[model samples]
Target chain A: MSQTDVRMDGSAETRADREATPGSAGGRRERLVTHRERADSYYGRPVLNEPTWKDHDIAAYLFLGGLAGASSTLAAAAELTGRPGLARASKVGALGALGGSLYCLIHDLGRPERFLNMLRVFKVTSPMSVGTWILTGYGPQAGAAAATDMTGLFPGLGRAATVGAGLAGTALATYTAALISDTAVPVWHEAYREMPFLFAGSAAASAGGLGMLAAPLAEAAPARRAALLGTAVECVAASRMERRLGPVGEPLRRSRLLRLGEALSLAGALAGVTVARRSRVAAMAAGAALLAGSACTRFGIFHAGMESANDPKYTVQPQRRRLAKKRAERELA
Target chain B: MKRNVGKVVEYLPFLGIVAVICTTSWLAGRSSLAGRPSLVRTPVRR
Candidate 1:
């Protein structure tokens, strides 16, 4: 391996140059130039620390939280519309997804008490704090609804719990966008305006996928509609976010996982629109694809943010652009 | 009277959750606008 000496001024000297220098230590004379003119940080190091969040744990947490929140809302709607089978399936899915989400969060925190400690204070500026409280509000209602539905007990109370969970569920579905975007991560923070809509749409798509997977074919029309609508919104919001971010969006655009997610979402939407309504097997396949797509999107976004945080150019270029724009405005004034 | 008390006890958890929601919402609204007096506009000079 060739060693390059990184200078404090963000320039690098190749091993060939070092060997050519008089009185330098011995090395092979290979005239390989690797340095290029671009935005760089001190010693070519990252300008910001990448988040320490474990990849699978936090990404799973995001996907499951969205699934749970949207499922709860879907459950409430189904119950109101008198679709018992869909309601029951959605309620149970919400509870299970919530359990998984909480587990992932607690696992990432390293302790259950640490997760609870987040509720010690609620600050409007702190998305994590608000999200913690939102989860606290949402969890029990989802659990009660699911338990009551499964056990056939407390019919009246179950309905109430479903409604309550539905109300909190909307916030749960979208607050995660705020949670991620509130960070200094370039990809996430720069896309803050569209992040919530993207997350909401992903959540809806996943919940619709779950409904179509578990519910009776006759009662799956709403799920089909939701899957299509959510896919459209998610696609539009994601593209808009990328367009608005320009060069800063490079990480997202370059992510293979994001590309796979978009392809899978589009395929699932097409399947749902065409053959899913006519065949149970097709519906199940489409539902699974949609669920996988939503998961991929969450993981893709998380990884893209990590990539942006670790790269000096992603940080430096955006800041320089902003400064340049401000200077131009000042000049015009 | 005993039945009413029992009923209240049964709904206690729900009530607690509601109270927390209300309190947090109020606090969040207040904190978001903390030190932002300009949001409350002064009357225009006639």
Candidate 2:
């Protein structure tokens, strides 16, 4: 009848403990226990706010920027190698993709002047500011190269612009990875190491695909090789990123779009190596697949980052693990 | 009919710019000699 109970081991127990224990004399009062198997936040709210970027706009911007940058580089290489057809096609593709990328970026910002405002200052620490300046410097050169190629005027100026754009393009292709990874999103932040390589490889593959689609077969051998090499690099970087991310990478692992993109990329590379050389239609189809695959990959990554940010557990668990690791290390020391 | 004609005329400049860009892109795609030919015929010596 007493609330306090004594054990044979000389320990005291309470009525509440008796009720909580199974098969106890207190008749085991029915108590509700809500056990949590994993980390969570108050009221099940996310630990981090989801990124406000629109998937259609930002993902397209990412994909088109990469395409434009890599195409300019390929155009420069084609020019140096005397593949005039490939050079013209790549230059045109670079300018077109750059225009689309700028449009998407401006559309996302909701004002054209907001883009110009980004140019008022240069910050080495900010990826967005650096990216704005890079785009500004790269855009005019790309436009000039494409314009001269289109009209057959200012050949000397075109050559200079082509080389300048090519130099800037390498940075443009990979900087978006830093922009996304610098955020607190669990998946994106964790992938900083491999993301740049993945973006660069995807850019190269898409550029090569464009060249193969538009240029003559006789001049497309380099494009085919580039497609194959880029596919290999992208696949390796993606796998390494997922593997290193562990639990934080669940969103990427579970993405059907990412898997489909990988499959399409592999199939495109296979087709490019085999039937693409023999038939123009096959080459075009393969190119289309590669371009679609790259676009899908960018969208998939954007969505996965959003998903990781929306879930409280992804943010909480990683911090908890790191704290535990530091505590253990301190104890050892 | 008059209203439709006025709208078309209003957009003529935009339409013309798009047409020019498209035509230039098509020409660039078709012409192999669109860009300047490579100045170096062979690999440069170190």
Candidate 3:
């Protein structure tokens, strides 16, 4: 993967080969293209050791993860309690997340039009490339399924759509972890087990926020519960990540961004639970906090991944040590 | 597919944006943007 070889102007590179970029940003013959291209060229630069994904990229992931997480939570809660209102909320939430995820996924791409090109060569090796395809596949299927909230409003085909969407939505809720877990980033990859559960919680809280903002206090009780549970999950996930990610996770442990994210998450979690018992307004406030907190978490994680990528120590050392150990064992045998 | 659908869906929300851009470019072209005298354009001999 060199970036310099690819010509952005001559229609999205139809060839399968990876493009080559110069070692330094300015070293290459700067071929200027569209306004967006010029802006994006500058956009990928790093000031920090690890530059987080773009704001839109982070925000889009946050929205989708939250929506997917929250909708599933609502679905689970609604199933238990037999509440159509809650169920309706879940479907709508899932659909919204689906649409937003699609937007984010597409918007985050250098070539939104050629997003499908991601499927050109599916490498189970590359988490980013794989995640792109997963996103492409899951987003629409799940979103369509979630549209059961509206699709069921139609006639004969509505029921079938509902069942199909339910199956898709179910898969969408938890698969978020697959996106991060399969990455080269050590912190995220290592935290794979917890990420799914953690995202599930954040998603629930996000749904709670929307529910609190929209639904009447009585109808939104499950959402409140979902928020509380999600908050707990997020807190636990954060703590576990802190403990597990070790030195490689220093960016997350030290950054001010992580601190803000922690504060917001804590505030949101506490507020959501307390307000659920107290007033509707309090619940709304908590929900907002949880939502913001989740956004921060996504941003923080994105930053950490970039950080992990930049420093060769973080990227190379573990693999080298593992390879050496394997070689020694083979020689001994 | 988003490619085909985006063609139709893409234009809906962005028409105003494209219009603004086109309008601005049209206006700029009509004016003397490239022609505007600058440090580079100033007489090197003088």
lDDT of 1 by residue, B1-46 (tens): 9999986675454334323322332232233233345433468899
lDDT per residue as tens, model 2, A1-333: 344442335344444444434434445544565886455453478988788888767887898899889989998999989888888888988898888788779878999999999999999999999999999999999999988977779999999999999889988999999999999999999999999999998998888888777777778888888888888888899999999999899999999888988888888888999999999889878877887777778888998999999988889888988999999999999
Residue A231, candidate 1: alpha-carbon lDDT: 88
Give the top-scoring candidate (DockQ).
2
In model 1, state the lDDT of residue B12.
51
What DockQ would you assign to candidate 3?
0.01
lDDT (tens digit, per residue) of candidate 3 on A1-333: 333444445445332234444432345666676556332122554323443456555544654655654564465456456554555555555555555566666666757666777778888776566656655554554445445434345433434444545455444555666677776676666677777776666666666665554444555677777667777787788778777767666776876666776687678767766755568567556766766676666667666666666655655555666788999999999
Better of 2 and 3 by TM-score: 2
Task: Estimate TM-scores for all models.
Answer: 0.78, 0.81, 0.63
Better of 2 and 3 by lDDT: 2
Alpha carbon deviation, residue A36, candidate 3 (Å):
44
Give me the candidate number with maximum lDDT.
2
Q: Candidate 3: which stretches are off by over 4 Å?
A: A1-53, A72-80, A118-152, A155-167, A320-333, B1-46
> Looking at model 3, what is the TM-score of chain A?
0.69
For the predicted complex of model 2, DockQ is 0.14
Better by DockQ, candidate 2 or 1:
2
